[model samples]
Target: MGKGKNKTHEPKNERQQRGANGHSARQNHKHMEMKYDKSEKMKFPVKLAMWDFDHCDPKRCSGKKLERLGLIKSLRVGQKFQGVVVSPNGQGVVCPNDLEIVEQHGASVVECSWARLEEVPFNKIGGKYERLLPYLVAANQVNYGRPWRLNCVEALAACFAIVGKMDWASELLSHFSWGLGFLDLNKELLEIYQRCTDADSVKKAEKEWLEKLEMETQERKSHTKKTDIWMMGNINRRGNGVQSDELESGEDSEQSGLENSEQPIEYDALGNAIHVDSVKSRIMLSGVSEDEESDFEENEKPVNYDSLGNLI
Candidate 1:
């Protein structure tokens, strides 16, 4: 009986220790929140919720991992989670690169299974505060170099980074081995995107990042010249490339000039170009009827104009 009592006491103590350890971990998570604190301190705006796009395997899934970490939760029993609901629709709010937008609607990442993306019911599960993350390169094993292919955690990390809580993103990602790798692959572009305040700015940053990436790729491929360089050379040889609109306008002007040139000009004996309108005006001023002017068609002579501004 003594031995049995001792054995029974062991698990209780063990369970207590385990509980203590869990409590410590929870405390650490709170400290992490403090560690990533901002001056304006828009706290980690998102309270995560899994949309469960497809039935995921209970053993091996990111959603399960997030549940283990206590990253997925809701404020109330049935209400949507604290953050905005992420959506792929182009109309959603842009990820808050600037502090003002963040305050209005902290970001959200739509949880979807990449393997069965088409199967997800995006329209049905979406919420009111629909937000779209800006262009981001995925560095996961499944979707490296792929834009907008982030898994649940990666999507949250991106929102954290965009809202200027990069440390928070890094800490959350530290839970997995490849988490840091994602940051490394996207480090250059993410830094640039974080600085952008709006969607248009984010787009410009994406272009700049792609251009730099292409240049680096070219440099890696045996020092070959870039297509842009060839284009520049051609432009320099051409002096100036006429814009399409300007070319069209010039063509129209030339065509009208050609049509006008068809009208025969009667030059004055003094070798001056006679104005057709002036001839008609003088004819009208001198009271020469259009009937009287119809007689000579073959040998048309220029009408002489006097200094008095009348046809002589």
Candidate 2:
């Protein structure tokens, strides 16, 4: 009976050892295959891709896949892209494999990639991309409350760099919110401004930027003013107290003056003759004719006499 039990246990042990060896062999085979496949080309699509610089999860990036594609290592912040109208969804200048679509808006979509796009002139994109740089920088800084601060200064610096006009940048920086992370930039711009050899040229560029900023500000103000006027009109139509009081006060003052003038006048002293004459002259100057003045005098009545018997 003992011999029979040993035989059974021996077979079971041998089977378990065989299973373990098979598993080890498979793992070794897989490792060998990986070593051999090291030179294999990475898999990536060849087409245009879109990316949202504003929000992208970096962990989702497939580094091996991106390296396989002939994509640049970096992309400009605030870059915009559109799918080719003719090419199907993600097929065009930007390879689609390097990015995954995260969001869609109208004709455009957002994707994620570390690949850089070809540099294009700001004017080539109709200044749309140029306008986005400020906001993008602000977003990158993670301080939206002062979005325009550094952005405005950076914009001025960029403009100056492009135009070769330092004074223009300085002047533009002056108008920006100084307290909003702009002190260092402002100082740098001032240094540039001081080094400017062509003040006139810089001045012209400064004027242009100022005019552009002013125009934008004016448009915003006009829109705000229109809204305020609409609100005020609505309130006035509903008879708001402030508007009502202003109107009421004006009417009351006019009526009071008229009533006082209509009351009788009596001189207690001869010295008041100049004052009365001056009043008469003022009325005549206001277009009351001599005949009208005489009518006014005749219509006027004496005041009540005082206890001293003198005319009050």
Candidate 3:
């Protein structure tokens, strides 16, 4: 009986000790998690932020993804930020000259549906430095290849790229699978933007690029028109059983002859015309009249078959 009691007590003590160890282990794990989370939240070069309106898919929202990845922090609707705010209605364009301001204050972009821009509280989201991104092509899945339709991540990346923070931009983009594509899509334009020393210079560069694009588009359309005309001419020649080269020469000769010959004031479908050879006009019947005599006299010799009723 004594041995049985001692064995039972020893087992209970071991069980209690194991329970204490498990609790301490759990506490340590939770502490490490909290420490890790803090580090993740603090990990970033420049303070990147977003004003998420929750108008997008949580899975596809780049802003939310950045927030999850600890690359960007989220702000409330009326939160005031003293940094470069990229807004569609911004008065000035972002440029490399804003680098100092961005580094000191940070950069932020509004995360909302482009189709619902009106619903966004723009006035409430105050910022000391509100600016617009110059012409840039989106590389995200939602608005890929579209101009000025960047999502949160792409917009933030553009802000970094324009402010001469390529590393920070690259870092933000690296979190996304299609991030590098944004840089590639806007490479030329971004280069032009970065070279700008001020916002006005950036605007000027954008204007020049737009003009060049328009000229190129117009030239392409003009070339297409000329091609269509050439094809039509070829098809017409084929219908006439005439080789294209021969048809060209024949048409040129015919045109030159028509230009050199006397033009008719009035003509029929069969190219018949009445020339005014008299000083005064004469009223004539439609058939077998003085007009017929004139036509026979001009085109052929008079046939003498009235007396014999035979050929002459």
Candidate 4:
């Protein structure tokens, strides 16, 4: 017997072929036809929102769908939690996609048109922990192939991916026509980015990925993004917590009754908009009511929860 090797030798070409096949298989995994689990229903931990500045089509918007599914529960601006505000304008590269970040701070996404970002009512809502999601391509009907034009749920799903929670993200997006396509586009980069902890690290990974995917990206004037110019806490002419085209069509104008008055919107330290007049039964300080006890009683005991905002 030959003073032998412990195992039979594979031909070099065969070994290389096997390695290539394995890699190809893995790459293909990201592109596999996305399957939806019909029975899969989940309540993701992060709070999602859309400022609804553009007055997104009620019929087609993914955020509205998420809200209907109860996956995106509405929380009043005054209600308390450590939250991350996703802004395309944020100078900080850090985002809420990391597990520690999500566990420590809940995530929120604002939906505004990338083209006319000036229209979003930034001053209406309060935000402290600002975050900027790195460049990612759009996969929706209106702005397909465009980067940074994500719908609300898709943006939140990316945050979910950053925190390494893919299942919940996928489930929310499964209802959209191009939902799976987003995950496919960002899987590898997200896997890389989620490992980063801070803003600088996240930005580093983002820069690398952007360079790699440089060809697929489209460039527009930086002016299109008003992330730097807008100031928070400066309520616009609308004066309420929102300003949209819907409002211009005389929706909230009558209810606000402030078309002539020039008083600035008053906000508490926590950023709650304080109306001079008692809010009507239809409008509430808390979430919209489907029940009769519509008044938001300040004396109602707050739910006792741990520091993590988890029920004790």
lDDT leader:
3
TM-score of 1: 0.49
Overall local distance difference test of candidate 1: 0.51
Cα distance off (Å), candidate 3, residue 205: 0.5
lDDT of 2 at 110: 26
Error of 1 at 94 (Å): 4.0
Clash totals in order: 0, 6, 0, 3
Candidate 1, residues 1-312: lDDT per residue as tens digits? Answer: 111111122345542233211443345345334433431243334445555432344344554465456555311112343345555643543544444544564544544455655655455555565666667777766676798777767877776777677886786678777888878877876787777777677777777877887899967652332222221212221223433344333443222232266443332333232335555632332334555444432257546543233456
Top candidate on TM-score is 3
Alpha-carbon TM-score of each model against the true structure: 0.49, 0.19, 0.64, 0.50
**Full ranking by TM-score:** 3, 4, 1, 2
Worst 10 residues of 4 by lDDT: 31-40
Quote the RMSD, in angstroms, for model 1: 22.4
Q: Which stretches of candidate 4 lie over 4 Å from their true place?
A: 1-42, 75-81, 94-98, 215-312
The segments of candidate 3 whose C-alpha lies over 4 angstroms from its true place after superposition are 1-42, 229-233, 236-312
lDDT for 179 in candidate 1 is 86
**Model 2 weakest lDDT span, ten residues long:** 127-136
Number of clashing pairs, model 2? 6
User: What value does the lDDT take at residue 138 in candidate 1?
Assistant: 78
Can you write out model 3's per-residue Cα lDDT over 4-59, one digit (the tens) per residue?
11112235554323321133334533543454365355677666766666567778
